[model samples]
Target: MKNIRNFCIIAHIDHGKSTLADRLLEYTKTIKITEGQMLDDMDLERERGITIKSHAIQMEYTYNGEKYILNLIDTPGHVDFSYEVSRSIAACEGALLVVDASQGVQAQTISNLYMALEHDLEIIPVMNKCDMDSAMPDEVEDEIIDLLGCKREDIIRASGKTGMGVEDILKAVVERIPCPTGDENAPLQALIFDSVFNSFRGIIAYFKVENGVIRTGDHVKFFNTGKEYDADEVGVLKMDMVPRKELRTGDVGYIISGIKSSREVKVGDTITHVDRPCAEAIAGFEEVKPMVFAGLYPIEADDYENLRASLEKLQLNDASLTFQPESSLALGFGFRCGFLGLLHMEIIQERLDREFDMSVITTVPNVSYMVYDKQGGVQEVHNPGGMPDPTLIDRIEEPYIDASIITTTDYIGPIMTLCLGKRGELVRQDYISGNRVELHYKMPLGEIVIDFYDKLKSISKGYASFDYHQAGFRPSKLVKLDILLNGESVDALSTLTHFDNAYDLGRKMCEKLKELIPRQQFEIAIQAAIGSKIIARETIKAVRKDVTAKCYGGDVSRKRKLLEKQKRGKKRMKQIGTVEVPQKAFLAVLKLD
Candidate 1:
């Protein structure tokens, strides 16, 4: 077996984690023809520098004429996959922590570095973006030593974009990061970090060998679930693609364990020989949980089946994701989907929009709430639509989020002021990096439901970054304000809120909804209310001029098309007699500004 060096790259969002991986692939000939004629699958990865998923690749290089196999794992930088980050760190013995020299260290960087330390991995600090005009390598190195508590000589100055200092960085990996240590004679075992599906190849899993060697046609079993499968082929992820091959201990590789479905091979599951299984799997694996949830429904009700199939296919590769069919008394049918966080939710929405070509209306996300009934029975309610009747709800509790903000010292005042305005309680503030502070707060999830991040970025001029985790539920005065259109409660107009801001919140939401909803042939009454009391009301005046101007034979098709579109659009609108509430009205309420 070749001497293997297994490591992972971690950083905060937009810190050039994926860019560094691309540079490594190009330099190591994993993407070019100098080493081997192959093109890096840099289409999506290059366009979006964020590694939305965890992936690994292998390259062969001769350092001092001693050929070494470098197995590099690229991980997601967003806080949404904090759980996945833990698993990826566990799969490697060391990590190359990339920090933006221009921006310095971020909250997510500290968070991920702590996770790496918890796994007891050797951290090799690297300052990226050295090619930028504003980059400060010396300052970044000082911050790394001060904040990360690393030695002065441990940091590497490198720019992944210009191919500067990359060789030295790789050499440092070979010398400073120790080779994988495990019982090579032990039973074959590897931990699945991520997996995906192929049209002809069935399920493909990317894993890191923790012990022994795995060969093709070996009978293997998943340690946690006790599920067995025959190892169909061994492979490695190269150029953002999977190529089949044999892999050994200390090497990160792919195993198509004759498991036809990706659901069978889950992230963090250990693969071991069925006959000679390891005594125990490596520690630090944790279950992935969804943090944010929203209701997703097709603009057209007939696409429910297609929606279900799309969700099933999405889940095939993402076992941590959860979704279920849900229905509203007024909206008919929909699905409540769970996500790791806001970025995850955005990616899913973008995928659905780009891949499925479906028009979707997504409701505002809500964290699970606890309800204490008049009988003193506490029930967890994930969906606001499913919350018990307010009359029966003796006490309502809302979810609390532990939020951290990384920003320049100048914006600390505005950011913290905004946080306090949102009913956020200050926890602590620490200097994360030179001139950058980490503001920790416990805030109501409801406050951040809309454009809190956007406002933060705006105030900080896009310099601030935010990361948050659900702390738990806290008892609070909560109510579900149901918006009505012509005396009927619109199913999509429900918002879980505190009683204090119900009036103004409802007013602002209804105003935005009114603006979003297009004018109709008939007038629509948009009213926001608490129970039977109307707090805010707006009228969507009927169309004063909407008919086509020309109806000649040449313009007949165009005229008919316009008329047909209007009729179909009107049909999609929920009409209560003369009142017409367009579907976009429900959507606009979800969009704060």
Candidate 2:
């Protein structure tokens, strides 16, 4: 226990967290240098050049002739996976706070720093990519000291690419971070931070042994679910899985209990020995709740079963992902899936396409709204199709977010304008450095759920970063903006918007749809309406045909007869024809300028 140091690396996206982890693995000889960054084994992660999940590995290092067992938990940097980072932090005693020398402190960096502080972890501020010509180590150091209140000499500067200060980082972990505290002789208790399903071994749970020892053949029971299983194997994670006889206190490893279903072992669940259970379950364990909801439908109706099977397989490793069978009048059968954020939703869609070879369509994302009826009953509506009648709903409340944006001073005016346009309330603004500022706002989650991030990036010329968390629900005058094609409402195109901007937003959406939908034989009326009142309208005229030229020097009566027949056919078609709305029209609302 005295020679063990458990820590994780946290940083913003594009920072060198994974690269630094690779260097540490090579310096300790945990894996061959030629093997590269083996921790990020997923193909999606490699393809995107980002970490989507937290990974753990065990390493042995010798410092001053003392052997230390170092457990390194490498966490993702995206704001979408902040929950994963928090769980990783909970399983460690210290954190290596990595910051890019060129980018300095970003929105996600500040969010992650506060999370580490909340866990009371010892943070070793490390400045990475210091060898670049554009590196501003001095300015970044000042920023770190100002934010963390650390000593000037305590910060470690390193370059993951050249491995300039990798050895010193390892040494700092040994001397500065405290070892985990637990009694091996006490009742067996472990915290499950993550889990993955294997076809051969069944459910494999990655956990941290908080107290006592767990070995093969021990009966373990989950504290929350009250389900028991016999441990089939116990092991530590090197570059690969290495089976061990047992796992003891202060150790991070995986356990296989012959459990076949991934749903049986949930992340954040406590495990204890069946015969000698712990007196109380571990605190701070809560199930992950999704923030964004969207409908995912297979492009072809015959592929619905294929999409269902793919989702079930993907959910084995992602405990936060939730879905259920839902059908739409316009979209047919599909699943209404819930995700942590937009990135989470996009990653899942990409995985479904890449892994399962399935093509799917996604609807506009929405947030859960609380609807209070005239009878004083409150109901939560996850889908707009499930909303009660407008007259039945006395008042509606929508989810709000506490948003933080970090950007240069030059883009402040445009950023503020963008936020205010989205119904954002300015809470506060602070200057973190000479040119960088942090703007805080309380905005509706629905506003940011669409194209708010894209607009922010555009206005700031891709220099701004954003992070947000749910701030509960608030009363708002929101109305449903319904889109109509040829006098028929398209349910999939309906969205909730603030009452003040409904008319203008409706106008833009109608105009955008006009550009996306193809012209038909009859005039197509694209309209946006709130209740029975039409707020905006656009018309696509029918394409004209050269009936007279086709006559070819015929008599005037012949030309008139052909034209009369064409006109009659068009009028008849208008009475019986249905306009086929293109998929692009459904998504055009997101591109509204």
Model 1: per-residue lDDT, tens digit, 211-297?
A: 898878888899887889888878676665554556677877777755665456667888899889998886668777676788888
Task: Give the distance in Å from residue 100's predicted Cα in candidate 2 to where it truly belongs.
Answer: 1.5
lDDT of 1: 0.78
What TM-score would each prediction reach against the true structure? 0.88, 0.94
lDDT of 2 by residue, 219-272 (tens): 889998899999888999897888899999999999988887556777888899
Per-residue lDDT, model 1, residue 591, is 66
Give the whole-model CA lDDT for all candidates, comma-separated: 0.78, 0.89
* Shift in Å, residue 475, candidate 1: 1.0
- Model 2 alpha-carbon miss at residue 278, Å: 2.3
Q: Which consecutive 10 residues in model 1 have the weakest lDDT in total? A: 35-44
Backbone clashes under 3 angstroms, per model? 0, 0
Give candidate 2's whole-model lDDT.
Answer: 0.89
